[model samples]
Target chain A: MTKRGRSIRVPVLARVEGEGALEIDIAGNRITRLDLRIYEPPRLFEKFLEGRSYLEVPDMVARICGICPVAYQMSAVAAIEDAFGFTPGPELRAWRRLLYCGEWIESHALHIHLLAAPDVLGFESVLDMAQAWPEVVERGLRLQALGNRILAVLGGRSVHPVSVRPGGFSRLPGPEALDPLQEACRAALETARDLVAWTASLDLPRETQDFPCVALRHPHEYPMNEGRIAATTGLEIPVSEFEAHFEEYQVPHSTALHSRLAGRSYLVGPLARLNLNRDRLPPPVAEALAATGIAFPSHNSHFSIVARAVEIFLALSEAVRILDDPPPAAPALARPLQPRAAEGFGCTEAPRGILYHRYRFDADGRVQAARITPPTSQNQARMEEDARLALERFGLDRPDEELRRYAERVIRNYDPCISCATHFLRLKVNRR
Target chain B: MTTIRIIGLGSPFGADRIGLLAARRLAREVRLPPGVEVIERDRPGLRLLEDFTGARAVLLLDALAGGIPGRVREVERSALLARAAPLSSHALGVAEALALAEALGRLPEAVGLLGVETGPAPGPEDVDPVWVQALCLRVPVALERLVPDRRVAGCGGRIRSRR
Candidate 1:
């Protein structure tokens, strides 16, 4: 007796951020081939940066992903500032960190609710989830709005904010502006804390696998705007040395590039960040996670929602802490930068994971060349690897719809901003 | 108290900006009712739902794909919902946002949408100024029809009530 070959094709994947497809081939109960096909046209952002003035890079990159515009802006400015040998003041740095916190909250909230929660809660869409869990959905929306408010205060608008510049912000909010934000964060803290427990209490699938986690690790704080790139495999490298350790390459099936750490697929984003930087969390956030009784350094990819929830708590707490001290009225921008010819690298912990940017500037301060490795691209390989392991563990013999749903759940777990990566999934399963 | 909120949703890219252009023009040219407000947003996504809060009626202006370029028409909520299969959460369009708003019970009593057809393959610079001006001239009339009682006072005899 021989097994018959069958193919299950999903033309488009829903409940994600961009257009993509997934194809899996199983042979005799084994996933012989899996491709997370990203059919969204390549955005060509890196190439667009070439020959543009360095001043425009921040705004240009910000257009890459609306959900994490601050990440792109921060990374671009960090790289450009490094090229110019400029360092912002403590106040400016704090503001940047605060801005990054806004992005994390907004991005994570959207993912946890609109994208991932429906899957976890066994709803077809967020609309369905909202009908059953209105309060939960409202909380997510409220938190998301708060994040946008913070971004609007700093960046001047929530979407593709225009206020960030190299060295410091182009504009700074008055001290009065911080008052409402501080109060809002304070109000949201309890909600964020509850979110952690809520996500933990969800009926999440429990499948742990051995995969190295990678994220930025700061000695004093949970990694956000600044840190060394560190991985669970004991690899630590400065942003400048990222190329020496991490590699990105194209696959035939996808338009987005897949990245590897030291020649192997590795995890990035919330789960990886939590696993690697659990110690760096604030005491309150750390205590909240501890209360969940789910230990960190968690190998379960499904726990990424929990990680996001915990980080939401961390972001709110950090927002409160940062806003507690009103920024003194000073020149919002540092001393103007002089055009220089140099190479610079910037790595910031985006909501998803470490976003790395490298730039070569001409003497005229034009971007001679540029490369941006977004978190989604970095996590692509790991997502595929996770999907294969997860589907195998899930039993490939299950009904095609069940297999497809399970695979989608595994991929959506990462909350891959397929738009950011030119990225992510329609599902096709071929069984033999 | 802005009871009627007209949100023009678009990006600066090509024909996609028709909504924004219409809204801005409407704000400048049309003397809207006391409780009416017009504003532009650039690809607000789920954030669009926020525009519905505290408003009794919400009218959304956007660029529609297919059909003759510059053809303006009223888009029903059902039609929007029917076409909205969001590929990504970040790319949640007007339809999904409205659906979510309805789901969360935040949808206003009266919701309406006006679309300016952008034709196929709209590029970064493909918007026609003639269509934009036409949208500006015709939208107020559509607004009158949609809201019924609201009278648009500006533009003298150029704008007439479809009623």
Candidate 2:
């Protein structure tokens, strides 16, 4: 029985790395409502973060999700160092960026080859992709494994890593350790460039949007670990005022709180980063963008897969370059922390997008309050709004599995980490 | 290496951690005798495989979600053995790690699985059910194969050989 205009939902979303659901309300021809509900059980990371020592913050936040633990670690340290009013030296900072690049290369490849491309090409999962496109999946796996290898080299444990501390690393990695990664990054970057070109030409639904894009910006380099916050609409603010402009509230359909700016929602992460930082992208990547003549910004979330691939290219190149100039030593971060009273905010560009962490420590050095805003939660509202717009523009003629597939794809694009979204994803209807 | 231990698997926080719950209930209610260790893990990952090696007998308690929901079923640990590369971040899932160990000629004398089926969308509170308790009886039921004696109390811990 071919059922038309019926919306579908998957209890667990795969590929983009966390758990989430897709809700589409289709009534005959016109689509009434569409929502990508992220119901990954709320761990309330930020609220739970209160009263923990600075040392424990990194460990506690890492458990927020398995997919992007490094993102959590980077953001936490940034916050910690900011709170203590210290900046990392050049060599140390380069290592941080290198680690982030590994994450980006690995994560982007996972999304491109395994998740997004499969959806476009009509495969159930990466498992299925392996049977059909063996080489592509193999390359993807090798790339992912290499990233894990990089993580294992630096972080101690690839998944939850114990290597990162306050000022820099517990110990600087040896040059020999960084050599193999450099070679892998070089190969992976070339592969990623080819992959991006292939994905950009795929027939996606024609849904260009006008999103209020936000991302980290650096005048000298592309934003990965450190940068000032900037938006497409010319709203630049210090990371400290993050909470002042943004608000998070829980929605009826989900436990996660959706975030918005001054009552209006904004988009973050890959698409936003690509649009806002197109200039900062490496020359080859910039040229790739130019060849497409994608003059303006991208609003189509489907193109997110393309953006991820391009990022993989940039990340691979950047990582190799950083590794080439190995730091003098893994800086000495073996500081015995003391109790302190202060407030600090830190923002880092995680693989998925902007990750922000803020903390207020008491005299005893215990965290009085801790707040984390990961990329997925920040993109929740934008995802739902994207769905509504897609329904209106694409014409909801979802027959049978098509509706479910479309919704799943939308959630997959943000790679909604419902686990992290648990801390955020506030939804409320505005009848303006 | 002379003694053997059986550990249950499942997570209490995860929606389908009931298998571990049942295994824990048995040991607590009926004290496990000497030379036999009963342990529980969220899931027997690669790390658990190392701990399980050289054991005479091992049993894993984990929930499997098939078409059947809330059905307590028992099978050999080998029955669930599906070999794939350890693609997960974990060193191994129970099935593959054990199979790999076996292929490397370090197989345990006896291995078993007590898979409890759970619902599509289970919650943290899905452990307490009449079916779950009834499923717990499978350990004793499975012990029937190992020990011929109908004696319910001792469940024959130090069996001589493969009965």
Candidate 3:
């Protein structure tokens, strides 16, 4: 009997955020080659930012990804503010945190319910999953809407929000808006807690692997909009020093650049954040997570779903806390800005992971150059590494369909925002 | 409380703005009944479900690719569901949103979609003003067809274009 080599190809990945495919080469149970191909055309947002006024940076960068526009805006504003040596007062900082909480809730809820759940629940998509578990779907949408409501109250609209600027928000919400949002957040706390328990209870795959976890870590709070870059590999640095430690380079198979921490693929996003900042969780969120009995510092990437659920709980609680002290009618904007020629860097924990931005501005405050590193691209190398290892552990002798499904589940665990990464999960297998 | 929602699902870019434009015109020109609310959304995605919830009925105005530009027609629920190919979670379209709503049993008892045809790769320049005027004129008649119990004021034959 002759052993024949066959290639299987999935033209487009489903349920992700952008265009990408996967190709695996196998020779007699040995995985020879694996490439997580990110084929989406590179959107040159950074290039477009050159020569734009500092004021336009936040809005322009927000157009990068619909799901996490606030992340872009937050990072952009933070960078620009840093450039001008402007530190927002306590009031502005609190509101910015609340706004970021809204984004975390929205993006995490959408991913946990719509994108990642179907794979674990043995369904083709969220629509099919909705047929079997309507209550679950409804809860997700409700929580997600609450998140969007928060964004609308602060940023003016959820998708590509507009109120963010270098100094502060364009207009602050009054008690009329804050009161209801606070009430909603308080009500949703219980729902978010249940979601954490529910996600933990799922019969998730137990394939754990060794990887370095990376995320922002703050001394007093769970990291979101501000923190020092920290990793499980005993690396800690300011956001300004990110480029010195992390390197992003292109590979032949992907349009998105692959990132490495000290030349090693590292993990980012929910799992990484949870691993690094579990000690910083608020008491209620900490208690809820403890109740799940899923220990933090988890290496299993599948636990990302539970991590997201936990963050949703944290985000809702944070929103409640912030809204309790609504913004004063004095003014939302900071003192008039005086721009100077300088360079600045900002790194925030985007829903997927750390989103970094660096800008070089001229004396007149126009951007001389810009660099943006979204989370998905940072996770690309790690995703490819995970796929190769996870597939081998799952056994290479399985049918192509099973292998493909397993491989996709691995990639989706990252919740890769392909549009953000130039990102992906079309599966192709070449077997001999 | 608004029992019927007329949502325009589109963005500010190019021909995609048609639904939003029409929605604005509807709110300004048409004298709708007390319970009918006209609103415009910029690519509401799954957020469209919120517009459907608690409403007795919903009418969605959107731009459809293919066919003659500015041609207005009814899009059936089945067709919308059939088009629910959610390629990416980020690109969740109206069809997927509607299907999810139906699946969760949250969709309104009465729902109708009115799509204005925008040819492939439509740009801002491709949006014809005359065609938009014609489309806007027929919207009230379409609304009457969708909800028979309500009559839209200023929908008479002698209606003049305010533009």
Candidate 4:
């Protein structure tokens, strides 16, 4: 092969949420650079939070991501509540967990069946995939609807739910309301199981790499809205210490910030959660994972789809269990919140990974400072590293189109949410 | 639980708010049929599909990007279904949502869309009064189109171009 410099540019990546571009430079079989440019203009959500009352944070932040509004709401409210030293009663806590599960199932199903599966099945898009696998697509949509129903039941509506507030929900759902949701989850559980089996049957590439897996770890249950931040690198810290352990810095090529733990890239999201918290999975989910035969502690990021499928199974099952034991009806909002000068930190396992929120409030409870680290930004550095490693393993001499597709698959495996991260611009391939 | 559901789909940001403004004006200025209801939404996608269930007639109002700014147009459900193939970048497009609802057998008996043309997404300050007037002028006529037999009695409002 002649020694020549080459570059692969994906002007815009499809199937994943938000807008992003991938650029790879190769000089004579040696990879030179891989940049995942998230050129979407910064929405400046944190800055937008300034001067807004604490009561408005959840709704304002929920606008940050349409796909996972509940994640933003959960993390925002938890952090604000931490500032006020407030905790919902057991009933509200259980409902919060149930809401989180609904988000997980909905987000994971969308990624697995609609976004990521097309790349694995070698189709252009989910619509194309649906032609060959209509049943699978329908199942995914139905599951997604079920997840939305959960949000609707508890939060009042799917997108930007109205019920979730800082202390608790605006309204608590009664036992009778859970009947249809429970039945739906039962049916979804079966479909989710079949989904897990189907995804496992796919011959996904097995290329495991060593990276720090970061997520929240609870004492006895799967991490949802509460836990200390834990990493496979023997690092554990309270959510309050997140600012010290992790930092987000920006690059000129992308508008979104890249995150690092102790000046080094790390990983989060489904792969991290599954690897770090396998012990916390419910019995049925554990059984399903075992049945897949894909070993735990999977390094091959491609198995993320499989991991997501397992989570869908877990979420539907969890929803059923939550509904089976309904919380007694209680007022959604706690007593009138009193504003004080305090700072609080909140970290929760979003559908993608660990989402961190910190807030500083004045005596009036107006926001003085706000910091949010979405999972996508946290994974940006790691995603770039994965791209470099994948290119090296796949061969630099691969055709541009092949390389582009490979890069897309590698990025989609992380399921980046550029929309939820910074915002959208456009992706263009400047093939020089 | 009205048989005739009128939804205004929009975001509060800039020109996107035209749909919401039109729907609000209609709800206030017009005395709609006995079983008619009007709603304002911030941003809607597939969720709009579920709103179609059990309705005898449905009329949607939204802002259309990539056209003459402030221009109003009436789009039919069939046309929306025809163009639903390529999904939009933001969540789900209206055409795709309608198509999905149709596929799931949830579309109502009569459905229509009335919208104003908008430019590139503007900030909050870009709520064009001209665009608001354009859509408002067409809402009552659009509603009549959706519910042909129903007596919708609120046509003599301030902005009565009827186009």
Q: Count the backbone clashes (under 3 Å) in each candidate.
A: 10, 7, 2, 1
The lDDT values for all models are: 0.80, 0.67, 0.81, 0.78
Task: Give the alpha carbon lDDT tens digit for every residue of A1-432 in model 1.
Answer: 111100000111221334568888999889999988754322366777788898888877886766788998999988998888987777888888889999999989988887788888888777778899998788888999999999999889998788898877778888678888899899999999999999999998889988899999988888988889999999988889999999889899877788898789998898999998888898989999999999778999899999999999999999999899856636555457887999999999899888899999999999888988888888888888998999898898898878777877888788776532212345687877
lDDT of 2 by residue, B1-163 (tens): 2444657776534536676766666666655555566677654333454566567766666776564676777766557555444233222356654654454445575667777766664433445555456556666656544333433334323222212
How much does each candidate deviate at the interface, measured as C-alpha RMSD after superposition? 12.0, 13.4, 12.2, 12.4
lDDT of 3 by residue, A1-432 (tens): 111100000111222334668899999878999998764322377777788899878877776677888998888888988999988787888889999999999888888887777788888778889989888788878888988888999889987788888888888778878888899999998999999999999999988889999999998999988989999999999999999999999899877788999889999999999999999999999999999988778999999999999999999998888887766635556455779999999999999999999999999899998988888888999988999999998999998888877887888889876531212456688988
Residue B51 lDDT in candidate 4: 76
Clashing pairs in 4: A11-A427
Find the candidate with the highest DockQ and give its number. Answer: 3
RMSD of each: 6.9, 10.4, 6.7, 7.7
Q: Identify the runs in model 4 with alpha carbons over 4 angstroms from their true place.
A: A1-18, A39-43, A419-432, B1-8, B12-42, B49-59, B66-70, B76-91, B98-112, B118-163
The sequence of per-residue lDDT tens digits that candidate 3 reaches over residues B10-35 is 87666777788877877777677778
**Model 3: residues with Cα > 4 Å off, grouped in runs:** A1-17, A39-43, A327-331, A419-424, B148-159
- For candidate 1, write residues B1-163 as lDDT tens digits: 6488889888766678888977887787667668888889888877888888798877788888788777877886667667656425655678878888888889875787888887775333466766667666666666576667767544323433333
Quote the true-contact fraction of every model. Answer: 0.36, 0.00, 0.36, 0.00
Could you tell me the lDDT of residue A99 within candidate 4? Answer: 91
Model 1: colliding residue pairs:
A16-B88, A16-B89, A17-B88, A20-A424, A20-A425, A20-A426, A21-A425, A21-A426, A22-A426, A418-A423
Ranking by DockQ: 3, 1, 4, 2
Of the pair 1 and 2, which is ahead by DockQ?
Answer: 1
Candidate 2 docking classification: incorrect
DockQ of each: 0.36, 0.05, 0.37, 0.14
Summing lDDT over every window of 10 consecutive residues in candidate 1 chain B, give the lowest-scoring window: B154-163
